[model samples]
Target: MRNYGVVIPAFNASGTIAETLLSVAAQTVRPELVVIVDDGSTDDLASAISGTELPIHLLRQANSGPGSATTRGIAALSTPLIATLDADDLWLPNKMERQIAHLERFPTTSGVFCHWRNFRNDRPDAPEAEAVPGWSRTTMMIRREVAETVGPIVDPPGGRGEMIDWIARVREAGLALDMLDEVLARRRIRPGSLSYGRDPARDRGYLQVARLAMLRRARDKAGSG
Candidate 1:
């Protein structure tokens, strides 16, 4: 099995983080290191983390958004492979195992991502395993070079669209990423979550991310020409 580390950016996720950690600990191919960046949570995050025995490196930073937290967590990782998970998400036992195998089979791909299904907070612990395309960071297992090449995730004004921006950069950098047609992650949809409710601010942030990508692409093309 390949050695990999996981980064989980958390902001006041005390209620759900334990379950998320449990899912990580339960993975068939467990991570060598788990970094949790606390974005200035007032909640009892320490208590929530005490329930897990996984190897954890905890970092505390003042109320930065998830993008900042995620960037910091990635900086602490030294493994060949890196994965990201939200503080409120869950992973199937074979998630890492399957991703590792896929990466090994496709040596040229920069990373591998799987599909995910959304479940409500009050729904059954195990929702239907079937899923649609999950192009989110939560389902990604990327090589370390890809993260280094992409650099830090860019935080948009509304604290959203950082992943979109980073993924755009990755593609622009000529790194190829592959997505598996299997479901390996579970996204919990709940009130107060970043993506739960549609907000005008989030919409604006996404647009900003797209605009930046377009500008970058045009600049790269002009330089090449």
Candidate 2:
């Protein structure tokens, strides 16, 4: 059996941390370890998981932002298979089982991602915000070697676009990414989320990542020629 761990990057997420932890605890295929990196949160994030019996490892660092926090958590875990979860999101019960199965079925792929539904934070019971499902950081399960090869996620100047940059790197590396059609997570659309609103700085950061990806691809093609 493959050992798996989960990394959750949280910043002042006291209100949603407990629920997020509960969702992980409820997974049909539970992870061997759950690591939470608290990025200089003033809130009582520790208290949020104190009551849970889950095997959670908590790490704290200065206000370095979500990209740094997630990178730290990934480095701290020794599991061969790793999954990432946002502190404000919820993973469905079969999320781990399905993703792991997909990886096993497609051994050539470096990672597997599943669809996710977006819901308004205030109205969880209401219809999903987006008609079409999509993939996010929380919906991805990747192998350790793949993550190491892709390198650490970039911490953009505005604290967003880390996942976007990482995905671009993955593509540039010619990694085979397998996508599962099933919806495996619920993404909460809240006011203060990292990707809540558009900002010019974030857009510029994405452009930089895209440019880097293009350069990498060009270099690869030249080397092959």
Candidate 3:
């Protein structure tokens, strides 16, 4: 079995899937396994992978939502460590090498999330910025065991914010998390991207995440009080 695995939940990512996998494939510590889950993509995404030189595991399922697709990928883990890269993001060449070193020092830590530049273009020198105040899902290197122990990824309706809920759950369960100072990933922002793009429907995703957080807070308080 490979020492590391990657899971990319893609839906209609015909434009970005190739570059995304290429970025991971170019890593200094290449992932031992690469799993791309097609969430009912109605595009040439399958054809795109057919041309790639990289050997990756492919799985197709109905359009159950991005979160659900990610859940399926998580369920397929067969390595001790797993990394996640979206079909639209790029990983810095040394992203994996550095994150793995961090894990070496913090063996008790369940995952490590690094900082990333958010850019809207493909320019290698494109000026970019990280999420202000904190890091988000764009940067993550997780241990497979930790993810399994926390329960599978939830296929919640809040496609974008499902990560926040999942991480919150992991933290509340006493799993240690480490943040690296290096910018390990590049987030490509397009006009129709779920989190950064215009969306009246996506607004509800945030609300759902916030509501869940509030409920968790209340439960924590009640337990303490």
Candidate 4:
């Protein structure tokens, strides 16, 4: 089995960090290491994980966007495979087991991602809604080589679109990403969450990343020719 580590970039996630950590602790296939990058959060994030028996490495940095925090966390880990979990999301117990099994079965694929469900924190009793069907960071597990090839996620000025940017780079590199049809995580959409609402700046950043990828592809083709 491939050794894996989990990185969680958290910022002011006092209310939900415990739940996130607990979910990770309950995974059937626990990660070799768990690193939580606290991006200058004023909240009691450290206190939340203080008593947990999970092998966690808590790193605190100056106020940085999630992209930078994630990059730092990834750099600190030595595991061959890395899985990311949002501070507000919860992974199903078999998430790591299933993804790792898929990667082991298909050696050619660079990574595997599964579907996710979105649940509103305010409506605890309501049924969870399915996220748009596709590969997402919340449900992604990738080999270290794939992440190194893609490089760090870009932290936009507005602090969003980093994952989108990274995914675009992954595609440009011609990496094969396999999808697992099962839902492996639950995304929490709460009020005041950075990822809860739409932002035009993030949309523009996505376009910019795509444009850069296209330009790079063109340059590579020209060089090959």
Candidate 5:
């Protein structure tokens, strides 16, 4: 199996990060390296991760959005293959194994992503939701070279819709991401999370990123014609 590293971007994720790292440790195919970028979290993120024995490389920076933290964590790794996991998400035990298998089978694909299920903490540490076919950075495994080609993940204000912008850039760069039908990651829905609250600003951020994506597409089409 190819050696791979994991990047986790954390911001005030103390309550949920330990479980997240445990999921990583429970992976059927272990990662060669794990880097956690602490995005200036006011909470005790370090204390939370100290209980785990995983050889985690922790980096700290002023409160940057997930995109910046992700970029920093990815830059710290030297592995040929890189995967990302959000600090509040959980990966199924075979997530790495399945994604790696997919990448090996489709050698020309830029990356591999799997479906994710959203769960709530109604019962504490339990997933109380059905699986859904969706794309999330947490479910992605890609070659290091592909990440370089896709460029940095954009950090939009409020840390909303960065992934949408990045995916648009990926398509613009003529890259393809192969996705599996199976759900291999679980996203936690919690109060006060960036995506949970009914915040108008979040909606605006998403719309802004999408608009930029549309403009980029139009510009590329015109340039080509």
Candidate 6:
């Protein structure tokens, strides 16, 4: 079994933190270390997750946005392979196990991602079997070094679509990315979420990042020798 590390970056996620942690603890291929970057949550998220039975690493930072929080979580990882999930998202039973098996089978493939289902908050929903237009962080795993080498999801407050930036960078670096024909994650679509909220500004930020990702891809492909 591959000793894996799972990173979760959260802020003011007390409402969903416990459920997320429970889902992680229940995974059939549990992570050796699960680190939660509590980005200055105002609630008792730290206290709630701290006493869990599973081995967990919690880091507190001064609300630096998801990009910075995710970077810190990645830096703290000790395993060669790292998987990430958001506080509002959840994984099916064998999410990591299947991803790890695929990686081990295809050594040249630097990243593996599976299709994810959209859930209404914690309520379960059926998986979207088809591949989406682009990759999302909810269903992805990659080598630790490779992820950092390609560049992580920075440029935050990238709002709803920041993941596109990182995914494009990995492919731009010429690392093969493949998708598994299975569903292993449930992406929460809560109405109050920053992405789904009333703030049009957040949506505009998301659009900017999405555009930036496409631009980066074009540049990288053009630059390819």
* Candidate achieving the largest lDDT: 1
User: What's the TM-score of every candidate structure?
Assistant: 0.96, 0.92, 0.91, 0.91, 0.95, 0.87
How many steric clashes between backbone atoms does each model show? Answer: 0, 0, 0, 0, 0, 0
lDDT of 3 by residue, 1-225 (tens): 127888899989988888888888788887777888999999988887776666688999998777677778877878888888788888889988988888887788888888777777566468465443224555777888777778766655546677877888889889998888777788887877775765657667777878888999999999999
What is candidate 5's lDDT per residue for 1-225, written digit by digit as tens? 489999999999999899999999999999998999999999999999997868899999999799889989999999989999889888999999998988888888878888887788433356655766656679888889877988899887667888778877887788878889888898888898876867887667798897898898788899999
lDDT of 2 at 161: 68
- The residue-by-residue lDDT of candidate 1 on 9-89, one tens digit each, is 999999999999999999999899999999999998988998578999999999978889999999999999999999998
Superposed on all Cα atoms, the candidates' RMSDs to the truth, in angstroms, are 1.4, 1.9, 2.2, 2.0, 1.5, 2.8
Model 6, span 131-174: residue lDDT tens: 34226666878888776686656754635556766776777678
Whole-model Cα lDDT of every candidate shown, in order = 0.90, 0.85, 0.78, 0.84, 0.85, 0.78
Model 5: clashing residue pairs?
none
How many times do residue backbones clash in model 1? 0
| RMSD over all Cα atoms, model 6 | 2.8
Q: What's the best-to-worst order under lDDT?
A: 1, 5, 2, 4, 3, 6
Prediction 2 global C-alpha lDDT? 0.85
Clashing pairs in 3: none
Alpha carbon deviation, residue 156, candidate 3 (Å): 3.9
Task: Give the lowest summed-lDDT range of ten residues in model 1.
Answer: 121-130
